[model samples]
Target: MAGKILISGGSGLIGTRLSEMLIDQGYEVAHLSRDPDKFSHYKTFRWDIQNSSIDENAITYADYIIHLAGAGLAEEKWTKERKREILRSRVDSTQLLLDGLRQHEHHVKGFVSASAIGIYGNSGDQLMSEESSYGEDFMAEVCKAWEAAVWQIKDLGIRTVILRTGIALSDKGGALPQMARPVKLMAGAPLGSGKQYMSWIHIDDLCRLYIRAIEDTTFAGVYNAVAPHPVTNQEFTEALAEAMHKPLVLPKVPSFALNLMLGEMSDVVLSGQRVSANKVLQTGFTFEYNYLDEALESFYKKHQN
Candidate 1:
């Protein structure tokens, strides 16, 4: 099943690793970027989402397209302008790709997109599956629009899979390092209620799920990209501290304090969804790291080496 793979957001933490893995597996991988020079190693195609333009060659040269380009939800304060940017980045980039595929003559077999579990919102202890009801929060709204744009490509007869990703744990980037830093400093404490369920996946496991979605023809629709077992904020904090051989010496961070510090964005940390990975697992995809402790250990072991 080796063929040319076109990836948007190829410069991101997940995309960079995915490109390396795909190349090692004998797939030709190219990136869609605004500045092609930034990705000298891969065949880069220029695409300006704001201007609604993409290199047609980027479209026609692919057997599969992985859409991962989106504004970081937690990067900036969700102001009126930033909110529009968040929605536009995901929706517009998707429209650009959809338009490219439609206008160009190409044989794109499948389209795999990155979506967040935030679509399920802060569902408390309820286990959120792919079929769960969507939340009404801003993050959820962004994901709704994003996934809707992706479905347009499916309507065009391309096999599409959307992975509603949970918090991806990695030492390279994403949420792991940010969480571990305070632990190493002996100031580690659970945030919010310390009882909110945190559904997470090791980065490698997440990338592997993306690969499976591309290679497995039976894979379609949405799947939750998360570990089999989800832990509470307190459990995750403890596992993280133990992984780095650190001590937790501080009290839990209060939700009110987070609200004061982050405004609306505080929900990102103060609340969470207990997402299920059974949907992906039922597709015969096995996660390398199913538990929080082992996942944390694997990352810190790499760091220690």
Candidate 2:
């Protein structure tokens, strides 16, 4: 029989691509969503992560469970209530799945979970690796809790892998498009000091990293899902402007202005840490687009006329 994979958050950007990629690779793919009707994929199922209710039948006889469900960190203002929801969505949904795994005690081949490089906090100039210490920030706290929740699966003797994802670059509903919008209008410029590192991965490479983790038995523990080359915010903005054939003479948004506009959410915009993908590369995963320019070019070709 072909491998059966269960995916949470399959409706989101990365999950949608990953589900399609897995199907193309001849794996049996099932996705967990709050509303299955929104997606036309035949493999989708309903699961209310907020209520801790999951369709247990979906995982029966499955070979792997790739959990990608979570509240989008950058989706809304970081109000106190919204922050709680963000953390609970990831941690609770993960616990719900672990509960099901424990109840079934089935020998699932692996449990792959989504994490973020935000756990490293705002490392000014340091290039972060898996061994780097967690930073002292709200996002770092959330990631720490998120990973801790997934760690429960280990007690069941199931192989669990956590992907500490970086900023994902794609034209379709990702950070790139939002950033590109301002630049396309000739009002686009860098954020903050423009010195903060933006460790990012092409959407294609990120999906492949998840697949590699699920299939490769030797892949355990955490891997940074970022491109081999990380660029500064200034470099990223300039490259994006060049790709869109726009002039890059606009002034950057100062950090104080961003904070005034976005409140706590400004941290995500004004601060970034460089992350290394060497571990994933060491495992023989090749990135299709390693450089920011190449990645931006592909996005422009696809989305820009």
Candidate 3:
């Protein structure tokens, strides 16, 4: 269970923490970065997905590969060019990894990939599972293509696990800080309809699941990386406000305003997916922060102003 692991997007929020955890557990860890020299702390390999090139040594050096590279979906407006970048960043990079693995002779035992619940689209109230039908939205399309590319790695006879992750809540980065910022400023409110369900998982829980995927040979196919209980936007906002010792003095942010402000990318916040983590739980993967209040408190209680 302890061997060399190569992580794509190893500098990302999840990857950074996961790397530390893996290294602490006495596993050899290396990063597959676009600029290898930029990361001096670990052994780094280079891969240029746009040019469809990857270091052959990267493929050979790993007992397992964790794919987390992709363009940030919410980082920019969904311009035509940005949309293409989002799709290509995921699909092309995965295809490149797949191609490199095929061309090289290596003992890559497993492929653990990061996927999103966006595959289920704006699924309203129905709880989405691994068997849920896909959504027709743009994110859904991106996730479908991304997962398709990852599955092709299975053709190489490697165990492949894809976690259709929900909004990862971390205090260092990702969703929690942005959500807590407004609440701390006394302007916190739900986005779009306050009733929209927000399925979230604590970052530590998520990273642990990723580690489990690496160690557990029986883990295959897709599992939703979300908490057991998904709360509505209003409920989440209230919990966040309480955790941060702040007050919600503002009304819900209107959907039309978000659409105008964010363009088509607004769907990321306006729409909601009530994803289920039962599949992951059935595999005996327990969650540390399953409830919204505890998850929020874990991040905000000590630092609350």
TM-score for each prediction?
Answer: 0.98, 0.96, 0.98
Lowest-lDDT window of 10 residues in candidate 2? 37-46
Q: Give the Cα lDDT of each candidate.
A: 0.92, 0.89, 0.92
* Model 1 stretches with alpha carbons more than 4 Å out: none
Better of 2 and 3 by TM-score: 3
Candidate 1 lDDT tens digits, 1-305: 79999999998889988999999989999999999977379999999999999999999899999999998866788789998998999999999999999999999999999999999988999999889999999889999999999999999999999999989987888888889888999999999989999999998898999998999999999999999999999999999999898889999999998898888888889788899888888889998999999899888877674
Q: List the residue pairs that clash in candidate 2.
A: none
Clashes of 1: 0
lDDT digits (tens) for residues 5-78 of candidate 2: 99888878998899889999999888887887784665777788767787777767578999998888778899
Q: Judged by lDDT relative to the true structure, which candidate is superior, 1 or 2?
A: 1
Clashes of each: 0, 0, 0
Kindly report which residue pairs in candidate 1 clash with one another: none
Clashing pairs in 3: none
lDDT of 3 by residue, 1-305 (tens): 69999999889888998999999988999998888877368999999998999999999999999999999887889999999999999999999999999999999999999999999999999999899999999999999999999999999899999989899998888878888888888999999889888999998899899999999899999999999999998999999988887889999999999899999998888789998889999999989998999998888778745
